[model samples]
Target: MSSLSRRKFLLTAGATAVGTAILHGCTSGGNAPQTPASPSTNASPAAGGEAPEVTKAKLGFIALTDAAPLIVAKEKGLFAKYGMTEVEVLKQASWPVTRDNLELGSGGGGIDGAHILTPMPYLMSLGTITKTKKPLPMYILARLNTQGQGISVANVYKELKVALDSKPLKEAFAKAKAGGKELKVAMTFPGGTHDLWMRYWLAAGGIVPGKDVSVIPVPPPQMVANMKVGNMESFCVGEPWNAQLVNQKLGYSALITGQLWKNHPEKAFGMRKDWVDQNPKAAQALLKAVLEAQQWCDDPANKEEMVKIISDRQYLKVPPKDILGRLQGKVDFGDGRTIDDPDLAMKFWRDNASYPYKSHDLWFLTEDIRWGYLPASTDTKKIIDEVNREDLWKQAAQAIGVPVEQIPTSSSRGVETFFDGVKFDPENPKAYLDSLKIKTIKA
Candidate 1:
């Protein structure tokens, strides 16, 4: 990408706000950092007041840059300020482990909530693709962040001159296949957003994920090391692993998820539904705290501080340097491409990033079915309403004093477009599914 004036970058980058008018430096490059002007010193009083039903709660998070909101909330005391005194933020090993811990509940020495994939709560709610056969009630109170995920290709692909166009990648895979080398690609989880993103990108290039190449599931933090040890040829995951791959010279990002779909929804603030039901006030308190921390995270000024804060041994467990570049939109596409536009940056609060739009969740659910992770006959509407806790988000939003004008009046954001120019209509998901030229499921 060219070095444009901040004003031009914001204008041409085209990451417009869907709901919030007060979008920060991300959408249009020229703007002041967004931070809460003031935070309360007062704590909620107990007994029939706004105090939490349960102050102690356990939240699980994977080691990625998007986990910043949960970490920042704890580190910055936003949780305590909201009267969630004994909140414990645990570092989880993988998505499967997080699900297991949530099933265990905090009292059983497991997590009550998590920094989770947007599609997971819906999947978990229906018992469609989880290890446990039993259905579990799940709710998405807020979105953790948008974009910031990437598809990193190994150094071997350098000879093929891999770019956004996957033709070379396909041809290279064919050549490797003829030579009896089985090419492989990996993502974080099945029926998860990362899996959908990788599948979409590959299918766009005429590479059928399950047929053209081997698809593997690896934890986010393990992506870099796995590729380094020759475990996989290419992988898609959220940062700082993608950035670390570039730093380690093992591979370069062929595409960021934002490039695939600008300001796309990523991780979310999801919890077991029964926990939220049993502790409604505690759920509200959790939302308020996470939202406050999200406001702090959207500020460009805090990106560096955030890198250091999450780099601690207990959080991301990686060097701060690997994370700072992508957060600042200084992307190294590892194959000799770079960009400096702030528009491609990860978002926590900007572009209504915190709102759990039902339309967005619908798209995820539809895509999961597209890949056959869920049955083609699955009812999306029922699952979305069951898993998305938008009402609770509104209650917390009111408590936080969000301007009345900024709150979204409806759940749907209307039609969503992709970098490849395909459009998804939430109202006509079946039509959208049928329109796809390459799909694991036939219409």
Candidate 2:
């Protein structure tokens, strides 16, 4: 059989096995507590519209600052305003935990949706990273935030002056390896956003990620503690953890990811496809609440209040100081370099940050293929169409009276140029793959 046909056969067979397992009371494991009961069919609708079929959903989020929109929506009663009074934004311990819970689903002790890494829904939908290898269909309702993630290096390499150019760090790793020490770098999860960023940064410096050094998974909240005990040399993750690392004097921020690719897409508001299909009106209500929260978060005047709310013990649980500076676009790299550029801050609504661009999804799938995470013959467009729910976003936007000018006219964001002068044109993904100097897959 051809490679593509073999892959298709495996996926189909695996799904059938998973279905049998579910029927026999065997399912993926997770410790997530049972969520509130599913939305009631009799719940009253909000003013001026038909009531949502369900008025409740359980959504998971990590402690990263990018999750602020979800936090804000719940904390500020935006969800209630949209008639979703029982929305629960629970905290997830790690990306893998999030995946497991999603697979279990709300009825089965998992979540209905989450504030997640942009590439994760696609990964889960393909069954590439699921525990049962059963495709868990998902939808991308909105892009939660862009930029703000960071690549931080332990103080051991502080003198190397490693920033965007990773050559200095590469030599240090090589020297350590020669002396019988195998250097390890960490990201939030394999084939996720942070993994792609860390890999791209290393590859751009002519260093092969998996061959020259070991790349491992480290949860975002554990990054600093792990580095302090000399667990990993470096890590890529979203803010407040990176900011906390700098505040604790454990590491220095080498570069905010915006320096890698300006305003790159990051976290997403994603829901299980089953939940969306069963509760279309409730889904739109949830999207409207998050969209309003995103606008509120992007406003400069609300920055301080937003930080304080998300820093509460129930949410991020970190001090507001660690999250505020970076959230305000004031970055202290902890290595004698600082920049105050609001344009580089994490954006929730400005510059169309909330829109789920098909082009961005394509880039992520292409990157997954490049790293051998997905089959080379994977149908990128079909997957994007199946997962991205930008149409839902537009409908919600119009329902909420969003200015027509703010709505994007095209799905593609055009060609994106990375810091190293490499460009990714969604129109021709093969050309972008061929241009990479280091990769596991041949275009």
Candidate 3:
């Protein structure tokens, strides 16, 4: 077959696999039927004792384990308990689809908010990755999760034993290019968490992402299928896709992202700024419900039920086994390596995981600048101040009686240290960028 035909065939096969997964209960676009809201209750009073102005919200989620809090809130009646009776937690096909639906808004047959990549709202607010390059102001109410994502490598590279250090694959990628087969790596979306993770992994190994190997965007669900068809050498995505890849014996996880940066921020629960401004009480109600759900999901005793509920056809649609292990921090790298460390597990509420720290947001923006996704001249702090609604998170946590200890004393999580000894001091992102050996933006 011609190379073009072969490429098309592979993509088609991957698409077919994605379709099958969707049929088994993944969400696709705005047309997917909404999951019926749990039974309603008396409208819960908001922070200031005002009743919610509206009871419904159209929220989007992809089929990943980090999205558990949103799914749990919807299934366990948390949303309804907080007076959001008509909340619809619909499934989204991919990150780009989620962005499109969020841009459309509920009134335009889209979503009002989503379980989204941490950098996405800032990207959207800046109009960098939008349909018309028009800014859509957004507010991040709370962080959904911390540290459950993974970078996976194809079994072909098993001999190299590529893990957190990607240097082993640098020469291999160069050889492939010299041999007339340019390798490609996949992530979920440009400027999204997966993309940044993949880029950082490769660059840390002295591999220039877009230059050394093509970095393409593949929706999270399709990562396994695409790798199975030889469409990419590696991928970065949230679980249980990585676990599924290992389960299917298609690839071995290089590293769970916690190893990249322990307890690093992953996803956020964000909504259209206009929506939040117009319906402040309803917004707090939604936040309160999700906050409660986060605490529920964090409990070790609830792990079984949490996995079962999210594995249903309407949510993630995967076997509970594929999700439970990683969700509990029992990682089987699928290459005969296993570790049980709850500290590296996906955190929903513990360790202030639910707080939308301004420092974390700044790190994301700083990384975006490093990759030239956002200009070096960008005012990251101003954008972060405007977009990160940590104050609202504090309000919801207090309203829900979250222990004062759980509520962060400061918006910054302090300096974060990575597996490679790289430090990102929230107070000085410029120095962090300067310290990086490979970056598109010069420090």
lDDT of each: 0.79, 0.83, 0.82
Per-residue lDDT tens digits for candidate 1, residues 1-443, read 12223211111000000011111111212223343433453655353477888888999999999999999989988898888989999998888888778778887889999999888777677865455667778899998988999998998788776666776788778888899986778888876878889989998888888888977777787777778866677888999999999999998888888888877899999999999999998888889999888888888877888889999999998888899999988998887789997778898887677888888888887787787666676767777777788889889877887766456667876677888899877777888889998887533
Please give, for residues 189-293, the per-residue lDDT of candidate 3 as tens digits: 877788889999999889998899988887777788888878889999999999999999999999999999877899999999999999999999899889888
Residue ranges of candidate 2 with Cα displaced over 4 Å: 1-45
User: How does model 1 fare in lDDT?
Assistant: 0.79
Highest lDDT: give the candidate number.
Answer: 2
Q: Tens-digit lDDT track for model 2 on 23-87? A: 11111111121211112233234656647888889999998999999999898887887788899
Give the clashing pairs for model 2: 45-51
RMSD vs true structure, all candidates: 8.8, 10.8, 9.0
Candidate 1, position 260, lDDT: 89
Q: How close is candidate 2 to the true structure, as a TM-score?
A: 0.90
Q: What is the TM-score of each candidate against the true structure?
A: 0.90, 0.90, 0.90
